[model samples]
Target: MSETPFDPTVLLSDDLLERFRERAAVHDRENTFPDDDLADLKAAGYLAILVPTELGGAGLGLAEASLLQQRLAGAAPATALAVNMHLVWAGVAKVLADRGIDSLRFVQEGAVTGEVFAFGISEAGNDLVLFGSDTDAAPRPDGTYAFTGTKIFTSLAPVWTQLGLHGLDTTSDDAPQMVYAFVPRSDAVVTRDDWDTLGMRGTQSRTTELHGATAPADRVVRRLAPGPNPDPIVFGIFSVFELLLASVYTGIARRALDLAVATAQRRTSKRTGTSYSQDPDIRWRIADMALAYDALPPQIASLCRAVDEVVPPDGRWFSYMSGVKHRAVTMAKAVVDDAVLVAGGSSYFASAELGRLYRDVLAGLFHPSDPESAHSTVATAWLGPLDT
Candidate 1:
């Protein structure tokens, strides 16, 4: 109901965002998680924003959550990226519950009580992503499943209480069903302190190794045929993950645009003896940045609204979702590139905010629905699958 509609500004204040901005560089320089930012957001009831009011959350929908993420990302990309994992599970739970699959009600309840849920789907070189898993999901007589494998790029690794992941159950009657489950942090779950990266370091997206980590029967959320099915779980995860990711990158574009404008206004051209804002070349660069950025928010909002309205989930939705994510990332990258040039060498300094943004925006290239995959999805939709 948040897109019915809610004000993200009211939910996230300027003062709060400024605080995050102030701390972002420090955390980035130190390659550390933004612990203070998380505490502030948790205290502000952000982690539960997508859960229904009946579940004691803000009752917001994907559209509203997208807006909130943009605002959050503008201040601290790493913080926003890390927070996205928690919000994603909440959004997925909302998506499933609205579709009459209320299996993730516990996730909703947990968020209300301040339990952090992290995504643990990614595995090294396992590019099949949601449709497949390298992890083993061994079923027990009690109906629980023990997952044994390593999950890479697990955000919020240090603090997540529940990890939502998928594994392949090759021994089940189905003989290869993909299993989705949530497991609490335990002795079996080990997080490697190996999260040093070029950008978004505050996420601490470390390697997570599940050494026969067990999920109780009730927490085993789904069992579906692997390889791109239209199960509600798959659709839900795709819809929320793509849109939220698009929102984050779009927000980075906006921040870069703003910083460029500010720099242009303050900088002076030696030959013209006036602000760079007056220089045709400088103005053109910023304008180009704006032009590229202008198309993203509306697109993200429209798609998010479509998701909120429960648009038909099929092959077409994946193309649409992936397309938006790909565009957002590409556009953000282009805008940041122009931003660095427009702002001059001063922005090249490691301490510069724009410099952090430049590095952080690059991480977008690696997220799902990557450039190649997004293009392939679009091509298949328009021209049908390549000659078999």
Candidate 2:
């Protein structure tokens, strides 16, 4: 199959990124709808990056998507978080596209039409767990699937035109494999139960309910062998998520350092008539923040590149990929903490950029690739290779 056509310039464009940064500040505090941010990306044709080339999408690869997510996060973490959801959905579709399915058509149409998409997987009952009984889809004789369950922390639920839902295939009794279903907002009854949280409030990730919502068979995408066992599609997609999340957190740290340096240079203490930048202690803190931010990018970049190379060749590397993501999250959280320390008391103020960055950095860690669990997987693998 031919690859999708993507404008290589979009990821590295400075002008576009500057605009995102300006808008990020405006939306950072309101915690309201980020219509403008999404609109800008939609206009730039980014929303369709994952759609197959035949389906009128850019068909961009994971590397490009990771770069875009990092750049976008530098401007607005909330927007990046929301946008990440769409990218991951598109990726999931791409993985299953060749599995005797035509789901790419929907992604293509939405991308071309500048339509918004969301991901609904996390649920209160599941507590953000990836596999659970609460998430299941039962098939009917009419060749339709009924998705009856409640999902929470669903980002972009209020404005999503389409949603990629994950659940168990109740119809399959052999071993209850994981399943993917494409749900349209119009066909499914959606309830936005406000996901008011302390961090990344702009995400508006809310609780959603689907009561026996019938989804067409074509809309259903499934993994050939979905089990607790490692899956390339699942792990590969997760690698992208972890790399990008790490990038966002890294960006947040850079922003924190920038603010600290700027403040130190401009605002001098009234008593000393000396610039904070000149202070030995302050300069040391700034240096520490910079080092933390700088050290993470190379590690994450290498890991992402490794995943990109490994996924298309051999279908193995589950333990390695999980470790990369796990490490990225751990390092990112530590870097964000360092940034907060450099920002000092001002970081606590809602109006401060450091405050937003701090909040945004924390949110990504809670996503599907929980760092703690990933570490355990890595540790087990390190102890001995899989015996089977």
Per-candidate count of clashing residue pairs (backbone under 3 Å): 0, 0
Q: Which stretches of candidate 2 lie over 4 Å from their true place?
A: 1-19, 25-28, 52-55, 94-105, 125-128, 171-175, 223-226, 269-274, 310-316, 384-388
> On residues 202-221, what C-alpha lDDT tens digit does candidate 1 reach at each position?
99999999999999999999
The lDDT of each candidate is 0.93, 0.67
TM-score, cand. 2: 0.84
State candidate 1's TM-score: 0.98
Regions of candidate 1 where Cα sits further than 4 Å from its true position:
1-5
RMSD of 2: 4.2
* Candidate 2 Cα deviation (angstroms), residue 160: 0.9
lDDT of 2 by residue, 46-117 (tens): 888867677788767666676667667766778888787787767655554644445455765776777776
The C-alpha RMSD of each candidate to the native structure, in angstroms, is: 1.6, 4.2
